[model samples]
Target: MQYLPIFTKLDNKPVLVVGGGDVALRKCRAFLKARASVTLVAPEFCSELLEHASNNEVILTQAYFDESHLDGKMLVIAATDNESVNNTVFELANKRNVFVNVVDDQPKCTFIFPSIVDRDPITIAISSAGTAPVLARRLREKLETLIPQHIGPLATLVGSFRDNVKARFKHFADRRQFWEGVFDSSVVSKVQVGDTQGATAQLHGMLDAKAEPEGEVYVVGAGPGDPELLTLKALQLMQQADVVVYDYLVSDEIMDLVRRDADLICVGKRLGNHSVKQEDTNQLLVNLARQGKKVCRIKGGDPFIYGRGGEEVQVLAQHDVRYQIVPGITAAAGCSAYAGIPLTHRDHAQAIQFVTGHCKKDGQELDWPSLAKPNQTLAIYMGVLKSPHIQAQLIKYGRDASTPVAIIENGTRKEQRVVRTHLGDLAQQIEQHHIVSPALLIIGEVAALHEQLAWFGSSAQISSFAQPLTDVA
Candidate 1:
């Protein structure tokens, strides 16, 4: 937080660059990209800089750094290889109170360049306050892969409708809510998938629909980490979600799938740390929906399975608020499948059961005997820390000490890891792997099948297994 992050509109601003070498060329190019009228002050210019000046893109002054160059300049950049010259430029710019960046000299700089990811109207700036430029660039590259190329065009589409949206929703909050709804709708997705016509059609439908103040809530399941695993209904609700209240298990990759403009609130619950209380989260959704906003109560896995989706829905119902439940790929099922373990197998397990490892109160009793049935498959959610206790109970309740178990950490995510062991050694195995939360524990013979069924280990493998996107008539 050393530098205040901002997107300065440089259009029609005069920017001075003091240098003629490679460093100066880069600064000049950046200024041009920002739509700044650049003036390069140097005794000589490089081939690239000369060409830019010749093309009338930049005004080149073949002269040494001077205070006169600071006149009428909104911003200045000193990129000369000569340290003394760069220092002189910094002093002159500071005297004029103009923002200046001395390349590679953080102490002398009034501002610093950031690693930029440009999607035209959609620009992502990554900076480490001039401490780590290489790390910033690396992060920028990683982000480039996650963000789709069509985002720029999609941003432009949103920009085009800004005036219309403002005209329709006069209140500041109302306009914010309207744009959030538009982002979650098919309009943005269609544009992202290169269907501009479809996007326009959907947007027009929204605009023509009678304006109403009634809001609703969609308790959406974000699915186990992977965005593609989301259900059609879940995806639909996400597209129309005015605000998304998400949990900790939801990955950044999955969150990125959410409409860019939608207000995202992290109500994620972590072990021993409650950032947003359950009751408060429920009320937040209730309050927003009452304001006629489409609220997406996004959670990891199926909403009904330990997701507290039912409770949120109950609150909505009590207040007579309209709501829809969008089922997601629950962690137990998704982790099992991705790890090549089936929750149920005809020969090994005739029945499958899902149970929570922890209770609302400490030391609460659970049906240990029934859960330890030899022929049943058990998937325990939020049970890693209690694995030893769970194993002891099951072993005491007729289950064999050597019953197979598998731990899937960060299940269905890019960094997912799976460890297989017997019930007696499952706790030791978890500790050895340093398996963390947002994981699933499977106990029974079916857990042994993970080695045979594991497939989503690599991006290429996953891509090959994915079903092709088909056109619906």
Candidate 2:
């Protein structure tokens, strides 16, 4: 790392800025925000800076940069436009063993400014160590949206209760577990939803649990691609999960939403490759739960669809483990919605069916004729590679060749794309669109509705028939 990450307490400290231009003004403002006593030395001052100095808010030296400006300052900033003057300030500050930043000159400075996300007491600082300031700022922008606005006040609330929790629960592990329970309970969620009174009540209830029951397991669905698509129940389970066993398909954004201290284990199974065997995953869950740890089996999309949720639940039941399932926006539902394709409609599809293309070793044919019926929407999961066979089988079973089909790639992710085609040309269209895996194929008359409902794809315009669905609370 070119720069070490640290948070300096600048309150009541003396800081120096060796410029008077816009750049210097920014540094001065930052120092003042930290409640620092600032001194600015330059040949000229901007109107804003002059007004501040006139009001005795800042000390100003109306002269060119000099080494004497470094004396007794806790921090120094060289924000001048001249590279030579910035270098001089760096050298003087280094000689005096003071922390200094040369604005936009990373190599000459002892410290560099970070792209800061300030939530008062809960500040997050992102830096690329001066290698890529733009990248750092971009990352900061993303994090700013992910973190709730009320996290600052919520953090203060937790801080206030820390000592009491520590004293109430003497055992280190028990205390840690209590805080985990408090966070996972309605307390933090209420806080996020702007219910401080509800959060406080919930916190007190947790603190009052003298002998709480053992932690349980939560089988959670991470939803399609968007973290926002995660159900409130899923989010609640994640907040309390002591350990998370996640799959490869779960997006980084969703994983980031998990508690930072949770033990994350990647048991993700690639299409044909398994990092850890399913049996081992089951054993891991049982072991963790036995230790009274709240484990979360986080799967992409709905847990029960193609996911081994049934098997996991069976194992939990066999072992008499306490657990609950938190449903997610299944792939078919999420992909269809975002791709503007309705799975079912009275004027088109009267029924919707979800079917997996993959079969067991003892090859048995799926009910192709039933799925090929008219007025029925067929959502084929894990079927991209089997499109040709599926299409041929359905056609052989008397399905219409002119049935509309939509191939949704990356589902609801930022890079999501959809291609509309007829069943006769579904395979060719998928190839043309370069549709990757984690995709779904929707076939039926309802697929044509995408022409009118495709709102998520940038290239696909929304039709007049498209309207906002009712808000789901």
Candidate 3:
């Protein structure tokens, strides 16, 4: 983190602003909002600053800023138009160990203001470490729309009952469960309709009952490598989960979105290695849920598509564990779009097939004749190790050896690489490039689109695999 995000209490704290123009006036107002005792030192004051001074809200001094102005201040802001003055103020204040902000100058700042979504006592602050102020403001504006106005009131309502609930339930866990039930109950609706008395009554009744917390599971797909590809519902459940159970396929970026306090457990599943066995993972989920915890079973790609989500969900069903399935963009679709290779094209491919390179434990082989048919695209997941066998079987089943193929490594991620070659050289290209797991194979005429329509990778990386397809016998 470039800037450690923290909330500072400025109430009754002394703060200094070293400017007099509109910018200084603006900074002073922020301090005033936090009920800080603000003092501004400038040659002249803006009309707004004069108004604030007249109202006894701020102390204004008609003098040029100097080191003396840094006296006994907890925080300082240099919002001046003069760079030299701002620099001087920063150096003096910083040397004195006072938190300082030089407006519009990120490098000179020890502290910076963030875009805030203020809902009274519920304040949301966002900052880009002064690198991108406009972006942060845009995000705050977007949040303004999504956050309901009733939340502030709801929090106030709940805060009023904290003592009563605490005294009633001795344990912290019991109190949390009571509040969770209160929120889930009609008390929220009563609060929304301005029925504070009714809401308070309902809350009291729930606390008296001392209801047990119910556990559930969120089967969320983390999507193929890209964090942005995650569905809205998936993101919501991830943030709300109390415990996160994930696999190796889930990207670090996706895991970062899970609830900060959530307990994280990695039930590793790799091509050949298993950190935690499948049966054990299922039983673990069941056990965790029975403990009344919200478990987030996060996986890469659509959980149902080669993710073994169905098996996990079936286990959950058999145990009667409550769960919500949230789908994500599968690698077949995500990697294809990112690599500029359309899975199904009007002229190149009329049908599409999703395949996995790994066979089941029972050694069930793929249907080569059906997969080898023409005018179709095959999206092979985890097919790197079996490229030779896959290439040989398809070719032997009447598929043309000259059919184009694209191997996407780290698909949909920033470091993604595309290696374009023909079917006869599928295994050769994979070996030549040292491709790794979590790679996807796009096979068919449509794979040629990678060169024509490629848009995601860097220029050199995209153009590196531009070898022409040669007819193979």
Top candidate (lDDT)? 3
lDDT of each: 0.83, 0.83, 0.86
- TM-score winner between candidates 1 and 2: 2
The 10-residue segment of model 3 with minimum total lDDT is 464-473
User: Which digits, one per residue and each the tens of the lDDT, describe model 3 over residues 267-348?
Assistant: 9898678888999999999999888788899999999999889999999999998778889999999999988888998998
Let me know the TM-score candidate 2 reaches against the reference structure: 0.56
Task: Give residue 462's error in model 1 in angstroms.
Answer: 7.7
TM-score of 1: 0.55
How well does each candidate superpose onto the true structure, as a TM-score? 0.55, 0.56, 0.62
Looking at model 3, how many pairs of residues clash? 0
Model 2 misplaced stretches (Cα beyond 4 Å): 1-213, 457-473
Better of 1 and 3 by lDDT: 3
Ranked by lDDT, the better of candidates 2 and 3 is: 3
TM-score for predicted model 3 compared with the true structure: 0.62
Q: What lDDT score is found at residue 34 in candidate 1?
A: 79
**Root-mean-square deviation (CA) per prediction:** 13.5, 10.9, 9.4
1-473: candidate 1 lDDT, tens digit per residue: 68998889999799999999998998898889878999999999999998998899999999988898899998999988898999988888898899989988998888888888889888999998888888999999978866767779988888888898878878999888777777655455467557898677667667766444457787888889877788766766676677888988888877887877899989989978989988998899889987767788888898999988899899899999877777888998888887888888899999999999878877677899899888899999999999889989999988998888888887777667778888988788878778889888889999888767766644566564343211110
